[model samples]
Target: MNLNESDMKVQEPRLWSSDGWTARVVKNEDDDGWAVAMTPDGASEPALVGPWTMGRDKKNPKPLDQSAFLTLVKTAREFVRRSEQQLHAALHQSIAVTVGTARVTVCLDITPDEDNPSATLSARDEGDDLLAQVRVPPSFKLSRSSAVAWAEGGFVKPR
Candidate 1:
């Protein structure tokens, strides 16, 4: 179905609706350029704020056409999926850290050795050089800030 300017136009800047998310290209508050915001349905605020770059770089953002709208929806949906996956990874799967001169990767891994579960923490250099191995207990803990900092330059001296 084709969506014309009259059909897409709304009285107000849509925050979000239960049906789905909405976004509009407008002048950036920080820059004179344009940007598109992705706000999920019923959301009070935008979830992702990115500069609209897929359209023809003309004076005006190319109208949201059928093909373009479908592409936009697919793109936005994929972004949401990736975001969810990253959140899940941060919560359950694995993490790689970057300390000043070191990188540490930690993860909860379950192998065929079900009789012996393990949490492995492998430290490496920025050039992907293996530094050391630390066998953590099954009850290992991790957080985003801690992981980021540890990856940035946080490490304990091996004694």
Candidate 2:
């Protein structure tokens, strides 16, 4: 009863766990077909869930094998990695523009909240010195023209 997760991993006909990932074959609630779920260790929900192959009998799901389990782990890992990259891109964005004789990096950081979303627009010089920052609308569009205009206008909060 005091064993750790390594000793409790289960590799059965419909389930497999290894390499910090688990693959489970379950009945698809939406239809008669079976489905496979790939969940990372310590995760509450699966990162990937899709259709599963049927057994020869066509009634049961195909038994999970080493090959299938490895494939599922690879796919699920990729899915999680891409999801993280997308979220980073959405929450933090930056662009470089020429402000007179100096180069400036404009950054937009968005904090998403159900009650009220917020965003901050900031600028940094080529030496990574904070030049100016202002609060902006969450819907503010960050583009080259907007960044140039902001710097040209003395870093004022854009209306």
Q: Which candidate has the top score in TM-score?
A: 2
| lDDT by residue (tens digit), candidate 2, 36-77 | 999888888999999999999999999999988988888899
CA lDDT for candidate 2: 0.93
lDDT of 1 by residue, 38-93 (tens): 66655677666777543365655544444444455567778889988875664455
TM-score for candidate 1:
0.43
Worst 10 residues of 2 by lDDT: 1-10
Model 1 has how many clashing residue pairs? Answer: 8
Cα TM-score of candidate 2: 0.87
Off by over 4 Å in 1: 1-19, 53-58, 94-159
Model 1 alpha-carbon miss at residue 140, Å = 5.6
**Collision pairs in model 2:** none
Quickly count the clashes in candidate 2: 0
